[model samples]
Target: MSDDELGSHYTDVPGQRVVAAALRAAYAWSVRDVHRNAAMLEIARMTGVVMEAHGPGRGPVTPLELVGVLRASLGSLLAGVRGRPAELADVVLLDHEGRLTENAYDLVCEHVVPLKDVVGSRPWLPSWTTMHSDQIRQQVFTAMIASTKQDEYVASRRFLVEHPAGDEQELVELKDRAGGVRLAKGGYRDVPEDQLYRAPNGKGWWWPCAECRWPMAVASSGKVRCRYRPHSAVFDLVPGDRPVLRRRDGARRSSPPAGRPAEGAKCVDAGVWRFVVVPGASELRIAAAAEHAGAKVLLWPFLDRFDLLVEAGDEKFSVDVKECLSLSSLIERLRRRRPSARILLPRSCEWQLETLQDALPELAVLTETKFLGQVRSAMRKAR
Candidate 1:
């Protein structure tokens, strides 16, 4: 056979010229959205977060599995750097399908990051190898500390053990960290140290760096509580799970229809939009579409998951509950409505009220708590 013909046949043979094309394709398309949501839903369900509301489908997790998440998210993002290396595109992908074993840590250290040849003491961003589960947990920890500088549980037990409750020393440390504390080692911190130090599982973290929310490990009177300070660059230093980014105050304003696109923008990289509507079409739909013709199947099937959906009488509150619930019984309910609908997941519960609106409206959304606050205020006003 000719060179071209022989080459084609050889590649088609399995396990010979094996190219991880599927994995590579996944990498290329792996934007932060779903990959991130998948990791969150996976862990939230597993940890039974906030009283196992995610249901029995998610069981308890061991320490090893926690470490795996830290490594995966970090390693994946870092990709092939000597400090954080991995198998597939750098860092392993962990699916929270079961109650993972702690042994997963041993597996990660041995299999995932086999070579610990640290070339320089440079700080690494939380690479993709950073564990997803751990990353989300850390983000939760970070957000908590960011909002409330004192993580009560961790503080009372860990730091308070040393500083004691009502101790002047603890309060002083807390004051310095709301804007983040300056470590003797280097860098100014931003997170609320008091919040992180008091969290339920808050042990290893040091001063809460607002920018990084990583518990900064500080050694002063000669003690390293969080020995993994430098490595925080490689692991879950902070809760990097991007919930949603809020533009700075005064950044947004009322727009008149098709406000402003940008200074100079290209069609292919619409930069901010998912799909663009062709200008003059009343109801635009792509047929043989342009270069980037893609399709999406949003699984939002509104159904009877709406518990106590008082059509009348009860004027308290109601949820436009989408069918992708966190319970097994809800799964059954979804199946009943499977023929007619799909589940709609907001980027987060925070986006619940706005998810149903026009995606292209260019409007700011409120938090879930904000909606609840409105409900409470309305009740008080009525009373």
Candidate 2:
């Protein structure tokens, strides 16, 4: 792949040509056994994925099929036919999690490998632009959007036919109100044109959407390109080096007793419900003054490390932090009624939850499920 050839296909950004050339170089290095043109393309495609998903300043978010695909990519032993190689299936895998035993990897000769390899190879920029044809790339994206709601649609692979040129395969387009394929600009690598065809004039998906989901890609730029959202209001942005920490939500609320005036600090030991102050209680005084009585203390952690998971008596108060992002105002109001609860958060982040934890040194960062399980186990033991 030459820079001039790629620059011609991509007409948007002039400066991007240099970026594209650099990406191709990285891609060329990633594939060691490239002998011919087709094999080279396949390797580039894989490299494009690595660039997109794990690119700089981006979360290495794994896609659903990634683990399985990675195993296949790694364990694939190839037979040298001429200069290129062919893969043979002589591998078996185990799923220790038992979630999906079909795809797992075992090392040390005893380690079970997944049926297929779906692992990260590296990150690259604008992966789609590198495909053999623009239409194939567009179709891949068409199916990806369907993957967003995998149940709703599959790519019209059944009705697919060889392109009029007899060189490429084409999946039909998804027609909106107008007669053309309708695709959202964001996350889609496809550009619309006469090549965008529809199945039976817009009926079915020729291929399964789930398989074609393009979660990330390399940029035509030297850097891998992934979805970039605005800095969440919850995160505080600052200038140069260390970012300032701030809360997107309100300060956490941990009330000792909603209706209390028990003289001073009272230490009641009753079991799991035998919740006593570990140490810090600046908020206790606030509760005594009736400032933050029953407000819930929600701890938001990085990658959902420690959620607001707890159980008090017969009532359960654990809420997955990620799910809380989708809650309505009324539900949030109702959740605040919980009095006195411990919220574990990431040692990092300036979310109000962390601030609350700072105010309450007794709060712990529940790092593992075992620690979380122990809390519940203690509560059960107390019961």
Candidate 3:
């Protein structure tokens, strides 16, 4: 059966709504004023709904119980119900500190947050509802899509990818270069405090992720890692007058220690970095690698119709990179909009290729490693 058909069986279930409420509650709990948040109220309402449907006779489900179930496993909460895919169902949505888990971020980006066009000025949504990073990302991209011509769109997006973070002067330079592009209007902001590491000398700094070169998250415990965990460049801050990062032992990959003074640094808003810079890093890397392998690559060819058009010898490959963290969400998107080019899973997302192929057998898909190998072989054949 198709993914859409499989998803249909669970549409009647309250799993999606329950999950959304749980995530919002988690976010609310992370902030200082939990009681004042609408998410707390929403979670209480959803708790009652869940109890009525799944665990009757269990009176007064506390917020803690709801959070515990979510932290324990989504499957535990939705047991005996064929709602979410096993991959997503088994995910732990909250960490011990009540922060949204990485998978929860993926879920928010993939499904929960509707694009600006779809949201369309709904009066029912609370005015106090702060936009999630993913929601903001969707809105920014939606605006870019509506405002710019195709070539301008590609240039604007490429600018964000190449310069996710810089100082005020750099931002001014970007705007000056951008001319009338909407991205020039409001694409950046002061880096968030949570993304800065405080040193023993009391100075704060931000470190760029080795992979994406965007500011990494600095945990209170001195652990430093990229918000997008796939980057996998973890480190610990060694406090000193001039603080430095110590590459944590057992890291899957290695890179040189990196940090920058955060005093005057501004970064592309969280949404843009998450949605654009993260994937764009991979897209740029793959394009560079293919060109290195003697392939002529055109990025966002035909005025942003697709990601890359690579030509090696007489062989041509048109590719659209897929770098999402959620497999089910990716599959659903693919079902909705058929891709015009072969889907290329970047190195970080290579694990998803088999599952994607299985889900959409008719679609053309390949991994970064496989695609690069093909490019090299084609180059050799021409020689």
Candidate 4:
């Protein structure tokens, strides 16, 4: 859905009202129209912003300004949430400050993301990724942070997260990634058609998430992505080929496909495999490297609050490994829960190491290369 239309689901509830107002205010800045409504005007003033009449006026607010307004708006809204059970799924509009609160942040992660039923919902943007659900949320949050950054007048504008250079190339990379272990233990297979939801009109079927088996939407570009985004892998139909589901009689269960998911298959939640599995894989790599380097290493120390705890020579270190697509959101989350463990950004987020160090100068940040080097150095000292 377009940013301007974000608040359509908002209502008169205290928290929702602020979200609606924030969305509208963000939209107003995008369109360069002064939001004359009291709520919007109050938020703008609180954000120290004054809308000026200029151009055709459909541009995004500067990222810094957008961040400021979102912070102020959420603070005001969350104040009214005191003594109330705030469901994370209920939050629509978000900013850094709102995400810093455990309740609000958890709400965003648990429910607000992987925007429901966005399949075939809107024209695809150049920056959109169908690979992982977390990537999708990161892109959405980036767009929200860049509300005034787009030129509404431009038909084909690149978003802040747009990786135009990687578009076709990445889709090519996705070809081999379409199939995965159904629930990471039920065997590996591609998402089958019968398991997918049929479109209401029965023309075409919505794609199922590679991880969750829930229906995924298609974008204008004909790319199939999970509404939940972090599911990550993008998919495309082989064209003219349809999935065929063999029927079953009463009280009869169909035999599972060799490696594919079937309707109503028992398995773990999709999100666990998608978000945790990959990082877990990285953790193994780190653990192997640490052990190979001859240091004593522990996994899931203290019941998984941290990924790895290592004792090398006279030095000891705790590490939390993260492979988040949106460094901005990850940074915001880290600010709230200051981990005693140093953060390790895996190869996937290697590009973000320098930026993260700058953002959190007080925190120790390491890339795979640097971290492995430290492990080796510690091993040598132990020897």
Candidate 5:
């Protein structure tokens, strides 16, 4: 399949590098301490998780059992940064503790890989960003802890998107406000430091998504492109009086124009876009409610390894706030990760209770109404 057809998973070269940087950072994190052997083993076990092969006596897979496979998979995924000792030093990844490396900031600025070269022929595995390294560590740590028992450990699991929310009114409102598609300025390849354009505010100019008005990424080809390709358009940077967006048809516009799709293109599906943002909006609401009710709440706590952690006086809860559009995908991830936190669903996805119960009967799944009630009860009891 064409790279363009595959979406950001392929065409997003900078994103891929960010993924590579994230992996390299993970490599560093795994090897950094006394826990290295355990960490590597857990990673190997997690890597070996095959959805269909999951059953009794299927795993408790050790890293040594799959080191060759894990190494091969990681090496191929990050071939671009291989053997670059100096560059690797410059690429900052999140440590196991969730702190960003001081020197790793803006690591993308130092390296660029070609768009075509980055489109590898491998099945993609979902991974958290570099910023979430600590969260990933926590997940693996939890898994490792569970594995030592020789008993099947499905860490406080839950099924999301078992069905669909009956009432999505609040979600709809939130989507209309902040969930619109956005864009940004990007480059196809690195421009000389002298030639890089700066805005009036002295910040470097980033291309904006024509439809959403969000900043797009500059790519290895030195052309500006949108990470969200459904809003992508064919364009080039015209370096005349100043750098500007020029359509393939030779039309020009002021920078960062928003609320309109690219020439001859339809705006991306609103439903598709809403799935990405509405959950976040719901999370904000949940966090606000917790705070208003006199609790200490952390959103995306510990690099967003878990969604929300709440402490109301003596009571505490770790929550994985979920709003999944696809029940299958949600189930698959839950099965693979087996998070230790309780999974909370917003009003937007209340309908999935039965299916979730059927699949993961032991999971502590709560709807928005029940969750809020629990929070209120916890706060009152604490007080």
Candidate 6:
């Protein structure tokens, strides 16, 4: 099959083009004075694509209309747009500030692998700007798998999950431990300015998300939260010589507030955090939960074959955690890559179990709650 045919078999070409174009336009608007001509051209191209898909009379005509439509729910934008499935209609694309919403982030990160092909190379929007997080993840994983020993790869992967953000000194130590394995240069970057909170005393600080332990985004309005909204712990910056996070919501309990000086601090690239750390957090949490329920748990067993292997009494269960914000994207991925073990939805994604089962009726799947119950029962039976 040709490249286009292969891409079409795995992805929605028109839908992905619409999403990539919308993202490029949003990034263009986010910048200051750079790539103005190229941005306009991109917006015009996006307009044409939208018109082609949704009918010239129906979709956005001007840049302002495009921005407005992007800020609305994805379902609303594609309500009558041709070729978009009904399942994705409810996914919100962008926030009021024109930033990609969490659901949109998941959609683009997982489904937009052929991004460069969909929207030909632009001088202004580099591959780094348009590429999905999973692409970077795949590159990094492939490199490690090819170069490092099995133990080395496992240790390196665990370190990334456990410490997504830390001081420069800590990162230096990580490099030293890599023992000559070529960690990708783009794996980490200085934490973005917007993710840091400026204190009243002219210093900036960052707080780790309660769940993932990565630097959270701090808005100009003093709002603090993780880029991955499912982390769900919101806070307000309490500025002082030493800044701190003050919990703003009581709906869910989270870890105690902790802050660190942002100076000389670095974090994994956004794509790495989204594709690696976010799901890794759930994998670790689920493993801990199973252990707490009196089961013996082994993480990433058999050279990273699956997420966790749990032994309760004489029963052994191998599960792969699925924690995605987009049900459609998750379903598509599972269809393409048949899993070797049963699928387990993390706490945040338990709602997807029913839909996933209905879509893949022959696939083995269960929620974290159900899995924990089974673990406890097995432990009792063994006793």
lDDT of each: 0.24, 0.25, 0.69, 0.43, 0.43, 0.73
Q: What TM-score, computed on C-alpha atoms, does each candidate reach?
A: 0.19, 0.18, 0.81, 0.39, 0.34, 0.86
Give the per-residue lDDT digits (tens) of candidate 5, residues 1-383. Answer: 23233232222233344344334334434343645655454344333332112333442244443333223332332334323323243333443343333223222212322222323222122123221222222332343234333112211111011101111343234334532211111101222122234544444444445543334444334455443333446456554334566565454443433221122212211121223223555676787888888888875655446788899778888998776533543554577567778998777567777787788887888887787777788889987
Residue pairs clashing, model 3: none
Q: What is the descending TM-score order? A: 6, 3, 4, 5, 1, 2
Off by over 4 Å in 3: 1-13, 33-60, 80-82, 113-138, 142-149, 174-185, 250-255
User: What CA root-mean-square deviation does each model show from the true structure?
Assistant: 23.2, 25.5, 5.3, 18.4, 19.5, 3.4
Q: Which residue ranges in model 4 land beyond 4 Å of their true spot?
A: 1-265
Model 2 Cα lDDT, one tens digit per residue, 311-367 = 434444443321111112113222433323333221121133433445445543232
In the range 1-383, model 6's lDDT, one tens digit per residue, is: 23444445565456765656666666665542566777777766667666666765787888778877777766666656555655565666656765556555545555444555435767555343466544556655765566546666666677788888999898878768766444566667778777887776778788888789888888767888887877878887777788777778745455446788888898887767877888989988888888988899887776567888999999999999888776877888789778989999988889998899999999999998999899999998999
Q: Write one digit per residue (lDDT tens) for candidate 1, span 4-87.
A: 332232212111101111111122222224355544433333232211221233312532343344334433333322322223
TM-score of candidate 4 relative to the true fold: 0.39
Lowest summed lDDT across 10 adjacent residues in model 2 is found at 270-279
Q: Order the candidates by lDDT, highest first — what do you get?
A: 6, 3, 4, 5, 2, 1
lDDT of 3 at 152: 65
Candidate 1 positional error at 171, Å: 45
Question: Candidate 4's residue-wise lDDT over 190-308, tens digit each?
Answer: 33232243433443443434334444434433445444444445554332334322212222343312122233332222333334444555676677788888888876664455778
- Give the range where candidate 4 is weakest over 10 consecutive residues by summed lDDT: 153-162
What is the RMSD of candidate 3?
A: 5.3
Mark the 10 consecutive residues where model 3 has the least summed lDDT: 114-123
